[model samples]
Target: MFRRIKITLSLLLTLSLLLIYLPQSLPIAGAAAAGQASQIDAVLVVDVSNSMNTSDTDKIGNEAMKMFIDMLSTKGDKVGIVAYTDKVQREKALLEIQSPSDKEDLKKFIDGLDRGPYTDTAVGITEAMKVLQHGADPNHEPMIVLLADGNNDFAKNSGRTQSQSDKEMAQAVQEAKDAGIPIYTIGLNADGKLNKQALEDLANETGGKSFSTNTADDLPQILSEIFASHLKLKVVPIQSMTGNGKFQEVTINVPNASVLEANISIMSSKPVETVLVDPTGTEVAVPSDNVLLSKSKSYSLIKLLTPAEGDWKLKVKGASKDKIDINLVFNYDLELAIDPIPSKTYKTGDKIDIRASLTSNGQQLPNTELYTNMNAVLVVKDLDSSKTEEIKLTNTGDSFEGSYTIADKHEYELTVRAEEKSFYRETEPVTVSAKGTTSSSGSAGVTTPKPADVEKEDAKPFPVMLTIIWGLIIATLLGAAILIMKMIQKANKGFVGQLVIEIRDENTNEKTFPQYKKLGAFKGKFNLHQLLQLAPELKETEGFIFIPGSNDRIIIRSQNGGTLEKSGRAVDISKGLELKSGDRITVPLSQADKTIFLEYLV
Candidate 1:
């Protein structure tokens, strides 16, 4: 058979060189286990005072919060809305629910909320903890959802009485339980002037939960059981077994949807013996009845409601040698993106093209190996000389392209990362437009000093001993006339010479380019990247003026705190500021772009 066709063509040439030298840094276990994600920041403290305007309970609290924002899951929650009375407004800010036109414009902005007159309920839980600490997404995991129908009355219409508004609503319920943030209240007690024990102490003081409706058809099953007890979707992972007492199993599969709410948890630093086996084999403690059993000093939570979708078994039985951990959450929806949307103006050598697209519960999902499964990075910042630039983005298939350059006029601050699974940073300052160079060689320790020129040391040739140089120049001109008369009596009112910076335009004084830099000597250290390479137009800056004691011109505009020492050491002028000769500083950039300078070391 011709030697069996030369052993099948040498085994197909060793499987074509192992698929062409495979090794794109291997390990991609299903795109890194499908990029695990489960963030969550939900906030919604409605009330609309005037006592829920005589009970439609604000239209049943806007149809149970638009059916709990249409069962949220744009890859694990993100929502906001405040609407209080007796103060606190913030209508919408923490967004990220990526589509369905953002839950239909947040249910038409919660049906055009309007009813304020008085009812503080602790200023709507401190403005939903200040919109989850200023518009969520800083590692998510904050929740509020309150709905109140009265209580904490704005003390006699804003005067402070009712035991000082129930002791500041129990100190805003212990600052949302010391920021482990959980509220979930909701009580519209149909006209009986709701309050229901301050909404059950703001949902039992934090571990959330406390619902009441009284009419409007029980507000959609109590806001769908408070969003099915704070939705989660899927997390599964905690499979282990070794010594310390036997039986350890995990099988979980669950998915044939219709309100799952499965759960599992176990912890140990010492006592363990968890057993949860269901899937038609019996033995359970939370298989329904919307169960809930919590514990904390280490962990032990159980909350199954209708969990049965096949292969579910979990058992752990330990006693000593520490090791018993299992945690599985389920609510569902995670995502990822990077698409063709990178323009607001890009032209100092452009080559952008960053792609983004992949939806988890909304389902678009095929990234087709967006760069052998992820790792990109392309930050760029200038924000008037804080100058940063981190680039890596290379993948060009499912999208990511690179090419960058900026010469001047920049306020850019773009970010795009993936690794820790898709993150997107933003700061709002993307201008970019300085190609023919007016400034900005792209930072890495910026430098632009070859033109503030000053080179004049060439007129010296008279050394012919004229009578022993006229008696050593008459005793060196009498010690230079007593050090120029003590430096002109300590130059008490300006005029020494050599520190000239002057970049105007503090709102049309218009000058920023009459370039003058003679900062030759103030005696070292004016750091701060040499004052941003000597006035690359300083803006929105922080302060500094420490030649402090030796001259006493200490300025302080820290807006928060100040400390920028000098002659007694401790310098890091945060990019520069220390003037003398009638100093007249003003820095303030970004949308009013001002710099107003005057420093004169003379």
Candidate 2:
């Protein structure tokens, strides 16, 4: 009878668990789109302490800063500069690069940079992050480039000790990591007395690369490499030219139609003149319809936009003693995507299968030769412990694949990066949780306890009263489980997920945080006016409405006298428009001088 009671209790507990977790097990309709950036936002943080007067007397660092700015796309990439000693001496807010004039403005700022008396690496990084925090766009990728020659050397009057500076630096780095920003560091070891480990730690802790140089003259090449790597591009070497005051021709192959821009960089002590000819043997004029030319004392950059796919000829001329080095950095509109996971639930010891591929122009990369020299790796980070692990992946002709066993009972972020000798690309991060060894957290499935052995003497006849109580308990749990299953089905059909929103006051140059609005609880129309409390200026426009649609989509409608847009194209929502996950909707309030951006996510 004791054994019978134990079995009855076990059955009751099992039914209770089913009632509690049934709703959570319901399948979500679709996955959210990967958070890929449409453009880039970068900050250059330079150390200008008195020690730099010995290391970078030639100020090649300034020229490198100019070259890096010149390489940004003219289609809205933004950049800022910060020069620091014990504190921030000079700074510029992020400025969008929309034309040649914008590039010149940033270069002019770089030219005005000078040295200060003390050094404080933490101050430089902190100020750079502050600049990005105020101006960075949610749709853009953000990064920081830091150059330092020595360690922290605070003045007595600065009121900052090494320990205090270190603490602030740690907090700043954590904030950058949380925001998905990487800080690339460059250490100048001109005197062989640089703090290499400090710079390397800053980079490694935030998913970035660290570079060291013995001479400031190498700054330009390192900067170029950093710019290319940050944008997932390849800087292909063309050839080294020995000048004889005559034009020499070189053939450049635009491998495929996917190439968006081919930036040809020529580096030498003196300027090298260049002429271009198309694949059809027709001479293309310099600085013409689609070509842009930028020249400095150390280098010349010729940018070709949407060039034809074939071998093109470039002619270069320089003085007899000039030794010019040429490199081609091709920027393509490509995406690295990770295939969907089979299970929505993850747990410690679970083996996850990761597969990723490259795509361009809405098509998978077709050439298998492109994968010959490529390598891929999986990066996983534990947000709770701040620990990271990397797993190497194998190339499978057309895609990359690997497997990773979850090792901890914590939330982990997974990202895959594929690279070759000259270029690398990474997918946006995906998050998963591993709830191991059922604990009090109630995050994992229930563990059943075995019934203990019962002595024959103790196994007496069961009481009739106990039997009735046991029967009632079983009936109650079973009924609850059935109701939970029904609720799960209803919720699945009504779910529309949520929207992540941000608002900007263009006139005042003020912005709001990225916040979420829940829509899953609404069955019909969701009014945009409901969010006015978060952004009071939103009250200026007629409210927007969203209703449920078929096949995991929402229908959007605008009220009278309101303007709506998608990707800069006006949306005629009078008849209602269907939008799926990953769609961004824009509403402009001319009266209030503000704009609201909404992104749908599941």
Best by lDDT: 2
TM-score of each: 0.27, 0.61
lDDT of 2 by residue, 1-602 (tens): 99657655665676656566569766433322232224789999999998887778778788888888877776678888889998788777677676688788789888888788989899889888877876576668899999887487889886889999999999999999999899999888887888999999999999889999999878878888888878877788888889989999998888766567888888888877888999999999998988888888888888899888889999999989788888888877777889877535666788889999887644577877667778999998998999988999999998999998988778889999998755678888898877634443353566544455355435777689998997787677777556655644543455466688798889787888886654543444546654342123455543577677777788778766445899889978877878898999888877778788988887
For model 1, residues 89-170, the per-residue Cα lDDT tens digits are: 4356555665456666677778777786776667667656765664455555778888776575554645666676677778
What are the runs in model 1 whose C-alpha is more than 4 Å off? 1-38, 44-122, 133-135, 138-144, 157-185, 188-191, 195-224, 228-253, 256-261, 264-274, 278-293, 296-300, 303-329, 334-602
**Backbone clash numbers for all candidates listed:** 17, 0
Q: Which stretches of candidate 2 lie over 4 Å from their true place?
A: 1-38, 344-355, 361-422, 428-602
